[model samples]
Target: MSRIVSLTASVFAIGLFAGSAVAAGDTITIGIPVGLSGANSVVAPSVVQASELAVDEINAKGGILGKKVVLEVADDASGAAGAQKAYDLLIFKKKVDAIVAMETSAARNAGLPIVNRGKIPYIYTSFYEGRSCNPYMYINAWVPEQQVAPIVDYFNKQGAKTFFLIGSDYAFGRGMLAFTKEYIEKNGGKVVGDEYAPMDATDWTAVLAKVKAVNPDAIITSTAGGAPNVTLTKQLRAAGIKALYGNLAVDEGTARSMGADAEGIYIAGSYFTNIDTPANKSFLAAVEKKFGNDLKTPNELSVPQYEAILAYKAAVEKAGTTEAAKVVPALAEVSVEGPRGTIAMSKQRHAPLTMYLGQVKADGSVSIISSFKDVDPGEQCPKLK
Candidate 1:
């Protein structure tokens, strides 16, 4: 673990060179408004840390456009108002060259309108529902349609005829449930029950009892962070109700937090500790070296943030400029080898190319259940024209 954290720290140092070098007296700043506090803090710190690592690596490689990149971070505290304030500082006050991210969709949605109005290119790092197509924003994570589609298909193959849908009562959870419900019903499955819990809610006994009563073949949970997921799984096992469990938002980070309770639980995801690729091997080794075997990275979100910084660097080099107009197209067309495999970007969809799907096993390890396939931006996106 010390080695992994040190590696990330080294990368963060190198990434400082990613912004365009100030022309003698100029400064190139990158605004990052991430969840540094509040309910999502468990996931937020990693995103910020990973982004710093990406910046450090870029700076070490000589930076974008021969200019040094300076990363300026602000705590969104995982709320709408806080995120909006962070963007105001990054754009109007700090005047950064580009913005890297806002971790949650709610925060992004709260701040994106301001970013678009200013025409500052921003990269979003979390997987979200796909109804957005913004010229000024780039999405590096999977969409609901993309991530949830295959999970439903897998359940069908497993003979899961009835499912219970539970999620955080928010846009991301609700949107995921909507798309999943459509897909599952279309495939001849029934949603026996659907429930929503507040994002910060800790007690899930009521929801668990509701699930137990329904006794569906599977449960599709779309909550955020680690607490609810860990609590629910532990209590369910304590109650001895062990139906097949799958999660959309639960990742390795979440799994590790659950300890022995996370054993045997399955999570559909894009990457894991056990991936065999050369880059992934190096990544895992570095992480193990830094955080130790004790800190489990359950989700694939961190490495993607690392790749986005790299992808943005590559785009800046190809375009020969960091202007949004130049860099936007570069970002859309750029592809890079990532821990999860190849990530490609589309002009129409700000999010990068999607590939491969896997499931988290007991003992907090991940196994690939499906190979990479290009996921097209679904028709649900509002027209930009």
Candidate 2:
């Protein structure tokens, strides 16, 4: 962790020095408060790398308003309190121009006090249970309506009306199930069972045994690496729970880690490895070139971190200033040509997002089963008005 912070510090210091030495007139610091340690670190490195890549690409293209972009990353260590402290340090000490965050909605929610008080632009880069409308915060990933709503419709179409809800017992999980439950009931489906596991629990046999006993026609889970999606699948399969298993948690990296055990699982997200777009192809090739075959792009879950940086760059350029008031409006109008597609932010909602549903192939690869033909930010946050 220290090595990572040192590397980030060094790179950012270089950017700062380069800003002064080169024609670049200023330096804009973007703070990242994310799970940089613990189990969630599997995705943190990629998030940092993606943000760095965006900064590099922008700097190479003359940067934002002749100012070099610098990243200030602090370890959240997968805890809400730790994430809040990281955000405070980055804001009070580093004095960053904007903030980008990862998973752990609790962390983001906790940091809202600082962000609202400071009134600096903030972008969240995780597919989450969204309903926040902070003028200063632009959520740059899929929300419940975009990620989970369609899955309910899909399952209903398949005649899988009964469901069992499972997830980590946290803001992200609880919020997701809240929306999922509403959708299931609205769609005429019944939820036969529900369960919650701690964010870092390793044993889920008890939960799986209960799920098997309930034996719903389908199961939906919202979880992350701490309580990996595979652990549930493994225990469920062993428990002889043959119901259709689906999750919003199984991204390409998770699927790869789960190996054959992940096959036949259904997943709903905002991005997929099999997206046939020039943007995605080029992005994947670049990631492969940089990280080698061992690392996967982690689906659209990882794309928001990359896109948020680019969006920040574009906002700075469009606003012609780094002031939050100027940048916030510019951000709502900025459309990023992300790997998934063009992601446009809506002024009504402080979020820019899209949606994609895919099924894990027998080989652990994903096949896009359905997609919103055009990326939409969904219903804008009414409160933003």
Candidate 3:
């Protein structure tokens, strides 16, 4: 698959930056570092498409602060080494003004120091483990408090007393399960089993057998990224485990891809494609019009890519310049009404977003059953100001 997609006709090639002397005022460049291969490849295309949609829309409205926005994309290839290489190329080689990145914690951790040294604004657009804070970096996705606590509360109300935990063997998976266990125990529930598999592992026979042996009231899975998530869910259904299933990592696109196997699985996130609000409907229509039927359904993982670009544009317009020192503080003050409703960047450098709890219907779409408004990330970072 091609790592770069140029939305505008006048996009400059990544190699052009090596010799070309360009003025930043002519066009603002936003670099996108995404996993175009490996474990995360299943969802990377949607992230890129969503970002292009946002760029097109912003350009249609005369671009950001009178300058057209262009995307310079680099493939992360779904690993730390790949992420480092991509970030280095985007920051030093391409000289992009800002970046929107979607990858695992390992990749993000590897790339953050480079971004910090460059002092370019980076918007991380994935739901991740909490307490990640760095200068010039902003997070647009839900953290543990914004996503886990509400879902656990809802599950507790549904008579789920004992829970089983499963995840990929990594920081994101382990960290999320740790938070889930904390919330479950704090809410008067007990953990019956906890298990983890490698991110690329496809075999889940033993894990499903353990779930059957434990006989927990509900099962929470945090399998990393796309393929592993589908494998785990499908295997669980095949084994006919009767425990209520709550998926912390499955997005709407992944759920739809699962077809009938995704039915009845519960999930919580900041956005679902089926949300009926005017803002959400507009976003869906724009996406459908832009990408037509070729694109997969937008999900929590992909939609935030669109929102992050819009937020960056807002911050740039408010600051009246693309300089990181000015835009970083401006980002904390700007809010954009996106598919997920009005999202404001917090003083802590993460969005204070709404949380939606839903279950997958037989048709592989989400039906929103409950929502928590204005959920804060609850972790404080160094103030950008």
Best by TM-score: 3
Which residue pairs in candidate 2 have backbone atoms (N, alpha carbon, C) closer than 3 angstroms, thus clashing? none
Instruction: Specify the poorest-scoring 10-residue window by lDDT in model 2.
Output: 1-10
Tell me each candidate's TM-score.
0.87, 0.89, 0.92
Q: Which residue runs of candidate 1 sit more than 4 Å off their true CA positions? A: 1-27, 286-298, 350-357, 380-385
Sort by TM-score, best first: 3, 2, 1
Worst 10 residues of 3 by lDDT: 1-10
Which candidate has the highest lDDT of all?
Answer: 3
CA lDDT scores, all candidates in order = 0.70, 0.74, 0.84
How would you encode candidate 3's per-residue C-alpha lDDT over 266-322 as one tens digit per residue? 999999987889998988888887666465678888888998999999999999989
Error of 2 at 164 (Å): 0.6
- Tell me model 1's lDDT, rounded to 2 decimals: 0.70
- List residue ranges in candidate 3 displaced over 4 A: 1-25, 382-385
Residue 220 C-alpha lDDT in model 2: 90
lDDT tens readout by residue for model 1, 1-385: 2212112344333334444455733445677787766556666546656666666566677767766667877777676888889888888977777887736667778888888877877777777766766777777777775677777887788899999998988888888888889888988999999999887778888988999898999888887655667767788779787777778887676676566777766665566667677988876665455445333363566766777777778777788887888887788778878676777666354443444556555655566777545666465434642
Ranking by lDDT: 3, 2, 1
Which wins on TM-score, candidate 1 or candidate 3? 3
Q: For residues 142-185, what per-residue lDDT tens digits would candidate 2 score against the true structure?
A: 77777786678888888897999998888888888988998899
